[model samples]
Target: MENRVEFYRMSKTSNPKILNRITEQILKAGFSGNIKVYDLGLDDEASMSLIVEGTYENEDCCVAVGYGMNRQNLAIRKKWFRHAP
Candidate 1:
């Protein structure tokens, strides 16, 4: 099966601590492969949006990550979407 890519929008704080925390959370939730967390510029609310891409064992894992991030105040832009590249 192909790897799944998920997207999320977080507060405009892209500090190393935040990035590391996100990466750690994803990995702890059973995500595999390299995880990339970068700012995708600003959103409509003027808050900095972040794009988190990684491979997971299943969609449920992604959902769990999203919820976890949400609890941390990261708004999930979309869940379980395909990334064309």
Candidate 2:
């Protein structure tokens, strides 16, 4: 995939659910990869996302947690990619 981060969100669900949903998507799609979770903690006020990524059927797919910031809807997109392996 290209060297850019696309926009995607998973239905505005609770934190861990985001990861769970993403995992299912990737797995069902026949993609194998790791989940890169960024947790700065709520105490730090650092907004981070739990990311699930992999290459599915030769296409790059990624899912991230989002509470809104980029104006995109809270849902998943097959176009999203993070250059993940």
Candidate 3:
């Protein structure tokens, strides 16, 4: 098959909820690749932009997380990359 990339998100939900949702979707899609997670601040617009660029530029897909943020709570963003072996 021709090479392809995909993106996914399961935010605003509990860990279990997100895990279950993502797992089901990933399994159904039969995806195999590397998953990367990045933690961006709540209002860190500049960093967020850089993160997006870093994740998407020259890559197949990327995911950005933006929500509540603080020293204690941190939002998680993930990106999945698929390449030929």
Candidate 4:
């Protein structure tokens, strides 16, 4: 099996509604297993990332959800990749 990854970005990070909707969509798309949320600090600002690692279309997959400034998101992405299995 091949490893797969998907990325999503949000402009409004402070809204819980949007975050919930995104999470719903992700789950509906077929990623089901362990869901983990991380709070990260980057360059003096708070950032967040959600990771869903499971099976998508019957194949192993990972989906990363992030919000906030582009630079911050980039940093979060790098951090996730650096520590991800």
User: Which stretch of 10 consecutive residues in model 4 shows the poorest summed lDDT?
Assistant: 73-82
**Which ranking of candidates, highest TM-score first?**
1, 4, 2, 3
TM-score of model number 2: 0.30
Q: How much lDDT does each candidate structure score?
A: 0.49, 0.41, 0.36, 0.45
Model 4, span 19-75: residue lDDT tens:
565456556655555544333322224444555555655655544545443332322
> Candidate 1, clashing residue pairs?
none
Q: What residue runs in model 1 are displaced by over 4 Å at the alpha carbon?
A: 1-11, 38-50, 58-85
Q: Between candidates 2 and 3, which one is better according to lDDT?
A: 2
The candidate maximizing TM-score is 1
TM-score of each: 0.43, 0.30, 0.27, 0.38
lDDT of 3 by residue, 55-82 (tens): 2434555444433323222233565554
lDDT of 4 at 44: 27
lDDT of 1: 0.49
lDDT of 1 by residue, 1-85 (tens): 4333333454565466656666655566555655555555554443445555565555432232232334444445555654454
Candidate 2 on 1-85: residue-level lDDT in tens?
2322222443344456544544454355455544343322322232234454545456656554432334322333324756534
Q: Stretches of candidate 4 above 4 Å error?
A: 1-12, 36-52, 63-85
Off by over 4 Å in 2: 1-14, 35-53, 58-85
Candidates 1 and 2 compared by lDDT, better number: 1
- Evaluate model 3: give its lDDT: 0.36
Quality of model 2 by C-alpha lDDT = 0.41
